[model samples]
Target chain A: MSAEGDEAIQRLIALMARLPGLGPRSARRAVLQLVKKKGALLLPLAEAMREVAETARECVNCGNIATRDLCEICADPKRRTGQICVVEDVADLWAMERAQVFRGRYHVLGGTLSALDAVGPEELRIPRLVERVREEEASEIILALAATIDGQTTAHYIADQLPGTSVTSLAQGVPVGGELDYLDDGTITAALKARRAL
Target chain B: MSAEGDEAIQRLIALMARLPGLGPRSARRAVLQLVKKKGALLLPLAEAMREVAETARECVNCGNIATRDLCEICADPKRRTGQICVVEDVADLWAMERAQVFRGRYHVLGGTLSALDAVGPEELRIPRLVERVREEEASEIILALAATIDGQTTAHYIADQLPGTSVTSLAQGVPVGGELDYLDDGTITAALKARRAL
Candidate 1:
């Protein structure tokens, strides 16, 4: 490789390595594949990346990503079920959307309250969420946060802030298709305590 | 997500899925990360992708990736060692380059001769390789193909075509750190047969 070509390829590989899952080795392989299929894969991927870079934006009302001021779920009139699903990030909102169970709006907190990172309610969209509860007149606020300590702390903080609203959380039990052998002690105990009629 | 935002994210995910190592789930995760870190990752990655898409090209002489007509190795005056390492694809060439053992030029065949796939010498760069050998007055041609059946067949065919030129192949034995217990039967056999004195 010439110096210029090598530099370009190295820059691409380095950028790719910074992605969520890809490492240096995998990034090199991905770059090689991209270079090999320039016309078919690389060009289209470049175009798509450019397009997303230009259009993707966060919704003003909620933290969900959208191209406009309001996200689709918030903008749609029929989705107004007087409920809002609160998540730690946009990925969680997408997962909830994929389930197609929640016919309501979403409020992304961007991150959970972490004492170690010094991330508090103000750092997230918690204040905006409280304002949305009043403006939208939401009857219920679903806390779809993780089961981690920070997740629980954030959930409790939000619950305390909302006095009149009904605050709920996702059920903690034996997950669907979860094997009993793989279950931890805490999970087994929780599953036994939350056992219901079959 | 609004319709436009959803479309852009979906398109980006689809394009990411077309990459060699990524699937639907990982593609979604990668796209989410890209969207989340737009200013830091997505925009820069998009710019890099566009740069590569515009500049990256195949070397006219050796089929290696380059921005210009000749790849760096072929263009460099110091690398003229009168020896050419022949590989099945550019990936193999890259692997060889990573080892930094071979100082000679390379000839990428694009693919091997596969009767099942109807691939022949004409389909690969076999003709161009023969021309390069005669024109460059190369003393040796290293057949660094895989240990597969097609690889052996192509090696033999190329050897038959080059009667006067010295032809060699990569050693077929247990890898450097490979254990006898973990090695396959064929590899163990090859290693035993190719054993040398300490």
Candidate 2:
């Protein structure tokens, strides 16, 4: 190998390191595996990434990722139960989808309202969500945002924007199967406050 | 997304999960990030993978990854110092290179002699190593293999094959910055046994 070969491998490693979880060392190991198993892993991965690069786009209606103008959920008429589940990002929407619950459509907020970052309603597609609720005549709006301060603030802002709409949030409590001893104070308090008549 | 789009994303996640440190959940996160940052990360990664897939190959001489028949170290005239360091894998070779300590060349054995896995001398590059030592007139053969039983057996076998060459193993003991209280029993014993004038 020449200097060019070394440069090529370094370039690949640098790119791999920028991935969500990978670092320089792990990237090296991954690159080595990719090189060693060219036919079995490398070529197929390259093709998949290329195909996704060519096709993947966010759904214009819901802001969820899709290959077409509308995502599968938005396209399916059966999913429109006159309810809209709002989330901070597409990843959150996917997490909700994985539970096999939520029989309604979604509105990906893209992000939360943050005074520190100057992120406001316009940046989060709040206007579009309000319009959708009015046009679709949605019965309920489930706020599936995170339990963080920013998440709560965003949810409240959205709720205020859509006055008269029945907006609810995910129940805050101790997780199912979670041990009482390991539960945080906030969770324990919330769970006790929201205790059901079971 | 359409069914085809979903399937394409799934394929990418599966391939990512096969990488060294990434699992299904992390793979999903990585894939989502890639999709989100298409121009910044995904397209460049796809191009890099394609380039590596086309150029990356094992050096015929030393078994290290390279773009050409001979690796950079083997191709360099300055590195032929009559000492050939032996390592179990290309990753180990890369580690040694990163240290920038060794001035000699290398011979990557691919793996150690493992009876459990039915690995033998031919499966590794042991035969090539012996022939190289003779042809290159090597003065020393440094075994930088792991301190495992299989690694020791492979090193001894190689030493026996080359009667006249000076074969040495990496010094084993407490690792640098390792605490004495936390050191393993075997390491403490090795460290005590190999105690020298400091």
Candidate 3:
């Protein structure tokens, strides 16, 4: 590479390295591949990213990413099932959607309440969630947050805020294909305590 | 994500999945991070890719990537050491440069000759390499190709094409940090045969 375009390539690699699962070496390899297949990969990717940057925004009602003020779920009248699934992030909401079981709307907290990081309800959009539940007259609130202490604390706080709504959580037990030997002590205990009549 | 921006995000993820070392799952994760940090990562990466798409081109002389007609190594007067290191790809040239040991110019062949793949000498710039060695009056031609069968065959063919010039290959031995127990039989045999006195 020469002085003219080398900096651009290096900058791309550095930004790519900052992505979630990529490091410096993989970033370099990816950049080289992009350069090699400029027409097939590089240009199209650039255009796609540009379009996303221009249009993507958080939905006003649910915090899910959308091009408009409301996400698909929030905009659709059929999804008003009076049920709200509370999650830590948009990615978690997407995961729940992919499962095809959740037919209601979502409430993205953005993050859990963390005392050490000084993150509270205001920082996470929790106040918005509380207001949304009341305004929407949701019948049930499902906590799809992580099993961490902070996640549970946030869930409890939300439940307390919504006194009349029924609150539930995803079951904690052995996964479908999980083996007993590989299971952690907490999971095994939970599974045993929640054993069915089978 | 909604209909308006979902396609753009999905297109970015598909393009990212095509990159080397990235699968669909990692591509989704990377795209999420880019969307989350749009100003810091997404827009900058898009700009960088666009710049590279406009300026990056293969070096006319050596097949190395460059903004100008000639790559930095090929254009540098100090690199005219009458020694042309032959590599199978531009990545190999960059690897040699990273070591900072080779002070000579390079010739990237683009790929090794493979009869199975119908890649002839003409397809890999072999004729150009021959003409270059003769025109430049190169003293030594260093073969920095892989140790694979096709690589050795290509090296031998190149040596035969330029009988007058001294041609040498990288030494076959245990890698700097490789364990002897982990070495294959062929490498062990080659190391024993090429053993030097202490």
**Ten contiguous residues with the weakest lDDT in model 1 chain A:** A189-198
All candidates' chain B TM-scores are 0.84, 0.85, 0.85
DockQ for each candidate?
Answer: 0.48, 0.48, 0.49
Candidate 2 is graded, for docking, as acceptable
Model 1, span A93-163: residue lDDT tens: 76666545567788999998998999988999999999999998998888776666788788889999899
Off by over 4 Å in 2: A1-5, A174-198, B1-5, B173-198
Candidate 3 displacement at residue A57 in angstroms: 0.8
For residues B91-142, what per-residue lDDT tens digits would candidate 2 score against the true structure?
Answer: 7777666545567888989888999999999999899998999888998888
Q: Order the candidate numbers by DockQ, best to worst.
A: 3, 2, 1
Determine the TM-score of chain B of model 2.
Answer: 0.85
The candidate 2 chain A region of ten consecutive residues with least summed lDDT is: A189-198
**What stretches of model 1 exceed 4 Å from their correct place?**
A1-5, A173-198, B1-5, B172-198
Off by over 4 Å in 3: A1-5, A173-198, B1-5, B174-198
Q: What pairs collide in candidate 3?
A: none
